[model samples]
Target chain A: MNLYVKQTRSISFVPKSILAVLILSFFIQCFWHFTFTNFVAKRHALPEPPKASFIRLASLDDSVSAAKLLMLWLQAFDNQPGVSIPLKELNYDRVIQWMNLILEVDNKIQYPLLAAIRFYAEVQDEEKQRKMIAYVSNKFIEKPNERWATMAHAVYMAKHRVKDVALALDIAKLIRQYAKGDNVPYWAKQMEIFILEDMGELESAKIIIGGLLESGELQDAHQRKFLGQRLEEIEQRQKKGE
Target chain B: MNHNLLLTIAKYSIWEAIRDKFLIFILLGFITLFCISLFIGELAITEGLQMQSAILGSTLRLFSVFTMGLFVITSMVREFNDKGFELILSHPVPRSSYYFGKFCGFSVAALIISFMSFCCLCFYAPVNMSLLWSFSLFCELLIIIALSLLCLFSFNSITISFSVVTAFYILSRSIEAIQLISDSPIVASGSFSYKFINSMLDVIAYIIPDIYKFTQTDWLVYLPDVKTDILIVVSQTLIYVSLISCVALFDLYRKEL
Candidate 1:
């Protein structure tokens, strides 16, 4: 009888200890979750994008889908961890890294390059805007034929957003210089002339228009006519200034 | 080889998948995941439908793989457990026919799933791209099926076979990326450990199928070189499937059923 009682006591002791620990664990879990739920900082914590290697590995050989998914996540980041984080307060360098990492997964996808010009460039920070513009410009030079539109947008962002006409002109010229294929429409290079004109470099613009007209690269008669009129207009403006 | 007998066994395998309600599970799981994909698409700031198609395409691709693997592993394991496998061998059927028939049956089932996924996604993605994606997915499935048979015949346990097959799929899929990581100059370079790791990855990559080349989600978005991609998938599928099937055959012949 004593032996049976001792065994029962031993078994009961385990349950009692385990039950106590289990109940204690429930409280611990609740406390941690509550703290986490309440204490997340969104503004200071634009997420560090996952490593490129990790992205490629986790993608299961479907790098394109992985790239798109990361793009979507970055887009929705205005609302991260259930809070609305203003883009200006976020670290732009980290944002650039995320874009680069997404491209590393699948370079064929244009989403990241597009996002640099269209999405992240909206930040109120001038430096962030410039950084985004530079990101797009660099990406454009890498595959100028593929990313001409992005470069055009970057030119616009630099000229208007960054208020840096010189940088815009540089990027605008890169579109024509790097793109050798006919896939880049003729109009993409016209931005350079416009930016040069905007910068009050009429001689440069005339030289460009003359070179283009003589090169017979302008297939469309309308484009050729526009350049002719533009050259005369630049000459007239130069004469009046003189 | 008795063509009729081979076909009969193949038909039996199909019937087994049907009896297990494989199609029904596929349909229900696809619908649920697809709806979730749509929900995610709605959240896209732009390209809502493109997002939807990409998400659905990728998710369904993976779902098909998981279900197909589970079906192959569980169904074969059931045959082993029930002694049905031995029952077939009790007759005068060539063991190669048995293996080939089972392989053909699973492959057909995989094709059906691929078709279903294609049809559902056609309205969303470009037709050419969707077709290529489906074909490549089918080829990918063929490799997995062959690997599954090899794993089952070797391990003969559902748990181990499933685990091993899953690991192989993962490693093969990511092996290219793993190789890149090991060879990356960003880390401390020229170290003995780094060189060893790189060499090991290179050897492993040579053995495994470069699954990174298969079932590219980019194919859905971009206009792929259809002829070239098809050629790649076909050649790789043929080589890998043949090799894996050979290994499975060797393993099966050695067993005293």
Candidate 2:
């Protein structure tokens, strides 16, 4: 080869060889990466959820994005390498803490509540379900009108997921006690009466349904009529029970 | 490829950057981002200053990369179009020498940005963590500078070169997330497409530098369990930057300019 060609070939050969070695190191790091590289190892490791205050700080006041990002990471956490941990298998304290943090970060979004209902509460373990329900129940106390729906989900978890009417009634009663304002949908307040009927407490259902009919908060004629019908149905059930 | 010639080229390039008001722009940008972070910092429920510094640090890191990338690409392309390369090549200098000289000049610029980030962040985090974060940022910038050089030499279009470099940076930063998701149960297994995709992702992951390991914002909030070692940081930077610079030098040699 001419001198120019020879020089060019030499330069190219060095770079190509360097690239080969660099690539080889990367590949070696992939299979047995912990031997040298923390990148691959860190990728498989689940991060401990940070404190809510710090998360809020890290978000730079963009609570909406912060909440969504946390929710995504939390939901995706159960799927680890080679083996997926069931949602029920997760650390309930951390999961609950994450939900609390996320909710605190952005109260305007229902993302955490949705996770509580759809993902966290849907677990097969009754104890886990109760924990999630209790979390939702307590969180609802802060903003009843906005959070009654999550409590309703908690009520569902109690009634269906945990198969405990008492716990369901407890959560359902919270909707009645705290969700008193008209701005909160009456349907939320009505959950308690429905749960009472489900529990075969016809007298209790009758009293609540009757009280609601007389409370004058039912501005909508349709709601009044629905409660009126519910009262009659409870009375009919009560007579049959006697 | 006289050592003095390479050093001279590097010196003049950095002087030219100062003349272009590049340092002033970076300083002003840093101040502005810090101020914005300050206002947003108060909005945090806790650790207002810590949040401010972390935001500022990460933003400065990104800003440095962008400005450096633009500076290198635009400057090189302008020189190439102006036949400045011919003027320099006529001085008994090899193409590899000129290419590496420019890389050195850009490396200095990267160092400035990383140091600024460290100085601004030291108040919020432990000095060692800030140092690691800043050093990681510097290494990350070095990779970008080298990659930008290769891209500019390869594509020769400002738009195309910047785009490819940008895409590479983004992929490197987020590639870990992609690999992690694939490793998780998110992707359905027992299918050819899944396995094939995973195999491809694995290879790509291995080929690229692990950028997600660098300049992490979490380092500001909580002390990481596995502290990123400075040894790995330096090694990865050296390997990737050297290999990329070599490739750029090789490419430069083939160009007629």
Candidate 3:
């Protein structure tokens, strides 16, 4: 009777030991998660630079000499080397600084601003990339020439770098609105379909491809063939799911 | 005396290899990888040309080595492991005829797979219609398969088949590096281990065919001025493949079945 009692006590002890270990592991995991979330939150909450004070050179009266000086100063501030140097030797921060100056002076110089957006995206700086993209979009709304460049840059940034599906779709819609005659608009639509397919919105992608095929706009043999193949692939995928 | 029967057996061997399930699986896997590559290609917005070339080049290398290695090893090993050779020998088929037939069969299958892969890439990716470079890449894949089969049947062991083929691939890639390292005076004057390593590398380079010679995809995709001499690369590939296949057949015939 006494030995049986002792065996029961040992068996109960095993469960207690396991429970203690589980509790210890749970606490450790929670601690790490708390620390990581706090670190990321604190970093994201930091103040951004004043966007309005940067130079605004939207007019012809802004002297050519003054623009040139501002460009030089921005290069120095951003630490970018002169254009003559090979790209490998160029400083990224200097490129961003010059881009900021261009954005400040003439919001119409979309390429430099796009370069700044690209630099931020490359570094995986999501906050800065987002800020730059938003600023460009606002400028694009006011100016007409920057439309194509803005849409293209946003498509690249959202789809590849940031991987923001909603933003990519919005940019695609914006391209269609702004770019009417050019091939860029069609390419943007294709990119949207691709993004939709990637995101598992098969029905939406099929509808888009079907509409393109039926619209008569894809008159070229090559483009038609490509669309046909893509639609067939999507249909096959859907059938398999069924 | 029975030449017709020998030819029949050889024909059957070729058919069996073409219908191999493992080879089909490898081809399907390669297709999936190619599709994935298009997604990865999007990341090359900054350095478009260089990145595209790298992605395509690496994709070709990966599929060629992996598919060729798997097909060659599995085909050779199964003949021994499954005792399929006994069935062939039970008939009136000459051993040499069987070996040659198997080699030819594998060669055809490898060619078809390589061509299909090239076509798929051409259709899917932004490929230029440069016949010479495309043909050269196909020939290169054939040569790689031929070398792998030669090494595989020579060893007659699946484990050795994989090891030797992988070794050949690495050696082929290292040829230029080996040459550079061998000519370095500092290395020549270094410790025993360093000298020994360099000497070993030199020996490997001499023994292995430089497979990198066949890689012309980058020039085709990137540089407009670069054009491959189609006839030269094709002839070189054929000569190398014939030599390796002949050696492999001789080895197979001499083995005690």
Candidate 4:
């Protein structure tokens, strides 16, 4: 080749090499990401947590913002035209993915968690509803924090969403353990009675009500009268056991 | 190949940007907005500092991209349309040198923006892993700057150039969503029409920058768990920017200007 053509060819080699490397690296990164999400997704070895761009805008540490973003994304599935139609048509797996991210980010946020629980229950996604309750219990209530309010919310979710009265009672008892004040323990006692009654554990529930009444914990006049009536009903049932 | 000439032109471009009123205004606005975000973050239930950092990081990315595109277009227009470029071309400088010099100048401006944003973020949040986000933002801006330059050189009209750059920005940011559409069952395994559309999307996907992979915004929130692959990001950015720069150089060489 002539000197000019040789120089031109030499210069062209640089960009050609660079282009090949770029394409190669791009595919390698893609394959790496694919393997991660498919194989290591369950292993939790994924390098980066993936989320919808809009939802990912919310910071992970900020559960409040995460909750807010989750709510907004869920609102897309509500009863509205143009927007809801597309979102509603989304596969259950897609909705589950969004829910899993939201629950992962902010299991302690009250309104959002409650809303998610209700939505999953309404959609008859029993597994997801149970998973939401389990997440709240595990991440929030089970941890060492003054999470009485959060525990109460979780108990409420268990009762309504999963209809697991026994599980709700266990959570209510766990709340009683973390209760630092008289007020929350009193509420927990009440929740225990209600859940036990719902579970058809009437004998256990009656015993709890009797102990609560005997300890004079139901000092509020209206509440006392209510407990007194409950005691009377239990006593009547016990006597009718012929 | 003339490194000294490229540095000189680049230094001049940086000086021009430093003196530009828009840069000053943006800097001031960034500081004010960061402070406002801190106060707004307090209203959050927990992780107030994380919230503040995220807001600042995202806003910085968006503002930097917009301003870089605007700056590249207007600067190119000022140089070419106003015959300012003739003064530089009168010298023995190559067209590629001039293009690379302008890119270097924009890169400096982008670095300054990233540094300022990171400084503001550090004022309220921890800087352990958050530094990765600013670095990624820098890489992201480098890609934008290169794209802006490429579009500016190819399309002489500022309006067309700006539109193309902005569209690229939006598409790159939405690459994941586009991939989802292509991957959806109806599209992936559907009839010929859907398959054709999916094929077209696949082609477009290959062309667009993957902006989603560049974002490490989660680091601004949960530091311990978020691992940003800086190697991949840096390598991808270098390759993309270099490729785009070569394209701009070739186009400018063919131009009769």
Per-model TM-score, in order, reads 0.82, 0.55, 0.49, 0.60
- In terms of docking quality, model 3 is incorrect
True contacts kept of 2: 0.00
Task: Put down candidate 2 lDDT per residue, A1-242, tens digits, no spaces.
Answer: 12122223545656777889988988887878656544432234444666554554444333444565566667778865546787766788878777777777656556577677667888888788877787777778888887787787788778886889999899888898888776788777889898888778888888888777887768899999888888887788677877
Where in model 2 is the C-alpha error above 4 Å? A1-242, B185-189, B225-228
TM-score of model 4 (first chain only): 0.50
Q: True interface contacts reproduced by each model, as a fraction? A: 0.62, 0.00, 0.00, 0.02
Give one digit per residue, the lDDT tens place, for model 4 in B201-238.
88987977677666555556556454546777888898
TM-score of the A chain in candidate 2?
Answer: 0.77
Give lDDT tens digits, candidate 2, residues B1-257: 77788898888778767767787788888778777777766554333555565566667767887888888899888888998889999888988788888888878877887787777777667888888888888898889989988998899999999998887887776676566556775445788888899899899988788776667676664556534456677788889998898888889888875
**Candidate 3 chain B minimal-lDDT segment of 10 residues:** B44-53
Instruction: Give the whole-model CA lDDT for all candidates, comma-separated.
Output: 0.83, 0.76, 0.59, 0.68
Instruction: Give model 4's docking category.
Output: incorrect
Query: For residues B1-257, what per-residue lDDT tens digits would candidate 1 score against the true structure?
Result: 77888899898888776667797788888888778877887777665666678788889888988789989988899899999999999999999999999998998899888888888778678877888888888998988888988999999888898899889888988887787777666757887887887888888888998777777776776665768767888999999999999999999999898
For model 3, the local distance difference test gives: 0.59
| lDDT comparison, 2 vs 3, better candidate | 2
After the best TM-score superposition of candidate 2, give how far the Cα of residue B79 lies from its true spot, in angstroms: 1.1
- lDDT for residue B167 in candidate 1, whole number 0-100: 90
Per-residue CA lDDT of model 3 for B74-182, tens digit only, reads 7767776888878777777776677656656666666666666566656433555334445566676677667776777677777887787776666565466446535
- C-alpha RMSD of each candidate structure in angstroms: 8.6, 19.4, 20.9, 18.1
